[model samples]
Target: MGNCGSSASSEIHDIDYGHERVVYYEEADEVQKVGSVYSQPGSKGLNQDAGILYQGYGEENGAFCGVFDGHGKNGHIVSKLVRNRLPSLLLNQRNTLAKAITGERADGDLFQSKQVIKWKEACTSSFKLVDKEIKLLDNLDCSCSGTTAVAVVKQGDGLLIANLGDSRAVLGATTEDGIMAVQLTTDFKPELPCKLLLLYIQFLFVA
Candidate 1:
């Protein structure tokens, strides 16, 4: 008799993973700036990654701009919201600030759709707009399902960065000093050694 402890063997099977079939549509406009989006493997939605670039001008200001990156499950949604809403919010904020100063809500009236306004004023307005929008998001419970948001504003040759999570933005400049790379955003997760190994296993046996 054969060993009682021995187990019977069946046939072996092979499988093929065709992940290359996935195609994501990315939108970009270059006349003013650049924009791109891509989803990682773990992304459960259309895109787990999102980014944006905005340009603004005023009377005493020129070209004030920003880049925002949103990362997480809802990264794509938040990113889309900010890209569409942030610039408009900034425009309104600028109007509010100008009014705050001169006591006239529409003093400079940059949104008249006429002449270009100053860059500094435009940029300043943008900053206030983004902050207000973020606060609006805070009123609701945005933590359990949250995303990383990093922003950058151009200030002359210098850039200002506001960060909440990981997606990074690096400033590259070449001058008399040479090539220098300045990192703008920092990751929100503190545990560097341990990575979040999220596994989505699907076992299907068609008979």
Candidate 2:
């Protein structure tokens, strides 16, 4: 639902939803040049989808993109909350992790691996924190309302992706024939063998 960039010339639009700050690009051309987004309301008469495209996120050239799909009565609120907050939350988590691993290291595959590990940890921790924040919202009824999130962070030539629920991320690669779409994250459905096993284990413990 929003996009942010580092360009001084880019038009800046700010909208405040309560105390939450939502920043976005006002130039439609600029957003279209980078990527396109589409969301339609479901039969329930409300669109529970939200997305964010952030440029110049962590570093000058870094970017962050995310899509969230909400379900249940308060799905719209949940999706928008995640959309507005997740990018900053993830960045904060990454900075915290980065501070813990300070010092120079040999620049090579090891450096890249370390970067990935830091990002992976940051993403996991941020997601958990977001979930907790949602649960703690006094005005929000989230007992049965939740959103699925799929996000990607681009830094230099590397990409770190995170997914929850059934939302998906895909890569478009130009091949000899044409552009090929490659699926990135696996859908986390309850019917998955791993999920079923975990559920069964929990059920056994309860029984």
Candidate 3:
């Protein structure tokens, strides 16, 4: 894990598992910028948290950011796998959806609606594909190990956010009083009603 600054001329920045890099937009050096990410290892001696920040992602002024939290044994591997592959998979899905709608009338509300639907579909498809890929890994044991993923994609003025498991995404908005934090996604935890119901069903079958 290493840290490097972004150049003023470039809008794109990338950070991987082992190699860490940060990009700041303003002239003054500040940790908090348009493209910045931070991750630290736990007391277990291995960093189970992984993240990515890509500026100029799908188009100019576009960005993609994700944070994954690993749990159980061999979870770090799973988190890294998702972090590395999910972005490309999502982009491909988005592109395919865009191509399919090329001839359609994309203006005003219709265009916005279609874009939202496509992005939601793309995120869903990409996540499923990543899960399948992880399951197919012969060298990895994921029976009791998994990772939570939370990602946000920005294209022009539109923002598409997706979450799986307990990871979260929050948006900081400038309010009249001060900066307000707006949660973008819900954390899917076992304490939720749906999860509790599923657990009860499983326990009944077991008993």
Give the least accurate 10-residue stretch of model 1, judged by summed lDDT.
Answer: 1-10
Q: Residues 91-157, candidate 1, lDDT per residue (tens digit)? A: 5655555453453336455432211233235544564555456547754433434454555544333
Q: Show where candidate 1 strays beyond 4 Å.
A: 1-46, 57-72, 102-143, 155-158, 175-178, 191-207
| Reference-based lDDT, each prediction | 0.40, 0.69, 0.69
Model 3, 78-133: lDDT tens digits are 88788888888999998899777666664666765776678777887888899999
* Candidate 2 structure, TM-score to reference: 0.77
Model 3 TM-score, 2 decimals: 0.78
For model 2, what is the alpha-carbon lDDT of residue 98? Answer: 78
- Per-residue lDDT of 95-183 in model 2, one digit per residue for the tens? 88877556635666666566667888888888889989999999999999999888888777677777888888888888899998977
